[model samples]
Target: MGLNGSIPPDIGNLSFLVSLDLSWNRLHGGLPKDICIHNKLPRVKELQLSFNDLEGEIPLGLGECQQLEILDLLYNNFGGHVPREIGNITRLTKLDLHWNNLSGTIPKEIGHLSNLEFMDLGSNKLRIHPKRSREQSYTKTQGNLIQSQRENCVLFVFTF
Candidate 1:
């Protein structure tokens, strides 16, 4: 489908909607602020808006969707800090926000997501706290892997 334009707010009325994948489209505009209000998307498990032209901050209300397992917004024009409220989604397993225009520090709260298995925030201006032990380990692991192919690899690691 060649869906274009902002996501309509009425779509949130689907009380039982589980997943919303509008990726690989020509969709533009930011997500409606109220779309993720409490109980609006009660059972939503996956929200994929990748490869679109969607711009604006990733809504803070999205954290209200406690059941979200995968949130992929990569390859978009979304800018602003990664919302710390997203850490509230303890069930999130995969989060990919790479290739976006987002800038800011990686929220420390993200490290609390023990269930996160796949996270890619590359191609953005985000940085991690080098003092955090957990982040250091993660950086070292990533750095070592990349260093194997290139002798001089400068790593700017972030925790999530």
Candidate 2:
């Protein structure tokens, strides 16, 4: 489908919808601010909007999608710090935000996601917080580490 224009805010009205994949499309625009608010999409487990032109900071309300397991927004134009609220999605297993314009310290809260099994946050301006560097480090058994060229910035992929 040759989708063009923004995602309809009314999509949140689908109370029983589970997953939504509008990836690989021309959808260009930030996600509706309230679309992911608690109970708006109580059952959504996957939300893939990759390969689009969507821009802006990742919604702070996205954490309300408590049931989300896979959130893929790779290859977009999204910028700003990766929201700390994302760590609230305890059920999330795969989060691919690769190749975006995101910058600032990678939230330390991310280390608390015990259920995260795969995450690719590379190719962005993100850096590990100096004080949290030790706290963010995982053993070899937890995941494979990929050191970035940026000094003091280490990005890893937790794949099991």
Candidate 3:
């Protein structure tokens, strides 16, 4: 069902929550700061809140969710840099933050997500400004794949 209101902070009390999909809804307001507070979502595997009217930075506490595998926050109004804390969730595989108002360089910590399979940071205010040594390392293997095709892609880089 599609809801059209803010999520209750008490909802985070569901310590047993395994998977939550709140996509394509009319929900507004920022997510609860305690949604994953204190490692609350120990069993959570997937959390999809895409295509909604939600705004604000992703809750910093989400990094405590050690079991998270898929996190989809696409097409929202979220702003600010991707949280470095998220890189602490070693179990993450798919992370989607596309089509938001985020800015700043992609965090180097994201490169540490060894399990990440898919990630999309396109269509936002984000930029890519890599240091020379890092660019050279990637260019050697990836062949400078990022062309100056789009204005927002001025410093984009790809790593396999």
Q: Give the winner by lDDT.
A: 2
Against the true structure, candidate 3 reaches a TM-score of 0.82
- Model 3 is weakest, by summed lDDT over 10 consecutive residues, at 132-141
Tens-digit lDDT string for candidate 2 (103-125): 98777787766677777887788
- Model 1: residue 64 alpha-carbon error in angstroms: 0.9
What residue runs in model 1 are displaced by over 4 Å at the alpha carbon?
A: 133-160
TM-score of 2: 0.84
Tell me which residue pairs clash in candidate 2: none
* Local lDDT at 2 for model 2: 76
lDDT on C-alpha atoms for all candidate structures: 0.77, 0.79, 0.74
Better of 1 and 2 by lDDT: 2
**Candidates ranked by lDDT, best first?**
2, 1, 3
Residues 57-159, candidate 3: write the lDDT tens digits: 8888888888999999999999887887888888887788888888886666665566666667777776555552342211222453433322232233342
